[model samples]
Target: MNSPVASNESLVSVENVEKVFRRGSEEIHVLRNLDLQVAQGEFLALMGPSGSGKSTLLNLIGGLDRPSRGTLRVAGEDLHDLPDRKMAEWRARHVGFVFQLYNLMPVLNAERNVELPLLLTHLNRAERRQHVAAALDVVALSHRAKHYPRTLSGGEQQRVGIARAIVTDPTLLLCDEPTGDLDRKSGDEILNLLQALNREHGKTIIMVTHDPHASARASRTVYLNKGQLSTEPVI
Candidate 1:
């Protein structure tokens, strides 16, 4: 694959990327010469088979993992060039992650759980509370802000996770099977919420999903197979 060129509005540029795994004397190739360019504030859905490296691609973009070869630039920073410590900090400031499971602490209330990201910054307690309150409001969970994770429904808990992701106002939101664990109705709510965030907050969302219904909600849907990317715009 040719290296994906960065356009004027590009937020992410993936150039000739490849990811390989070595096991004993054998090597497994997950991504092979893949190319992609994500525009700023674009909502992209990544779909593929279970082993097609969708999560690996998201991880690369989030600075959670590195590709074996090639360049990945997010918001003008070379993701592969950052040191581990700097990468962690960069993710906190620029990237937010939502996973299939709402990985909230068992003892923390929704407000505190949403405040976790803000704690890494210099924000005082009142500032943190303001951010959390606004985030929860965006997801229509303001009424449940004081409830513990265990006390909320699955959809509510996931909404809390979404609030936590956006509290810091990250430019990029990366979700890995965020609705995989929810029922159809609950999943639809989550999808609609994500769309609203993208439309209103201008978040650069890259979501990985296997479910067709979930992917259909994205502005653009791309398929990955055998380590290559195929784009199909969704009307």
Candidate 2:
């Protein structure tokens, strides 16, 4: 795989990474010696076709899955070497995820949903509440704190998802097609929020997207094809 331009202060460093899955007797290769470097405070857009291993790569960087071969480092920790339990702890502290489908619990109100990640932390109830409030405010959804997911608009639910992701103040934000399900206007709103998070708050973000408009919001964009990183999309 070809390497993108290197960063001086890389928060994510993927070197010769490979990911594979097994289905019965068949071996599926999803990533092939991929190499990437994401600088701190950089908002990177990862573009690829369906089944191009974009989400798989995001999963690896976020410590949700392990690479089959080679080094994977994020926020200065070697994810490839961590045990499952340790990896879980590391991920909770260092990674936040925004899914394409909102992924909010139907029963929980906005604030409660945002507070979920803090539940795994050592913070007390009051402390968690403080964090949740600040996060909701960041997303401009404090007014909807008591509103459940079912009561909110598609865009509003995504805001809640963003709030939940940032409540932990994670080292990296791994977003998988975060705006895919929203309309153009709503998608722009989410992109604006993400841009503000990167520029004003210095949050490092890696977004997997198929839309060029979404990718255009990023500081840098890279393409993935056949499990390899490239400067141009493979056709």
Task: Please provide, for model 2 over 108-180, each residue's C-alpha lDDT reduced to its tens digit, 9 standing for 90 to 100.
Answer: 9999999999999999999999999999999999999999999999999999999999999998899999999
Estimate the lDDT of model 1. Answer: 0.90
Models, CA RMSD each:
4.2, 3.9
Top of the candidates by lDDT: 2
Global lDDT of each candidate: 0.90, 0.93
C-alpha TM-score for every candidate: 0.94, 0.95
Q: Which ten residues in a row have the lowest lDDT in candidate 2?
A: 1-10
Candidate number of the best TM-score: 2
Candidate 1's residue-wise lDDT over 38-113, tens digit each? 9987899999988889999999999999999999988778988799999999899888899899899889999999
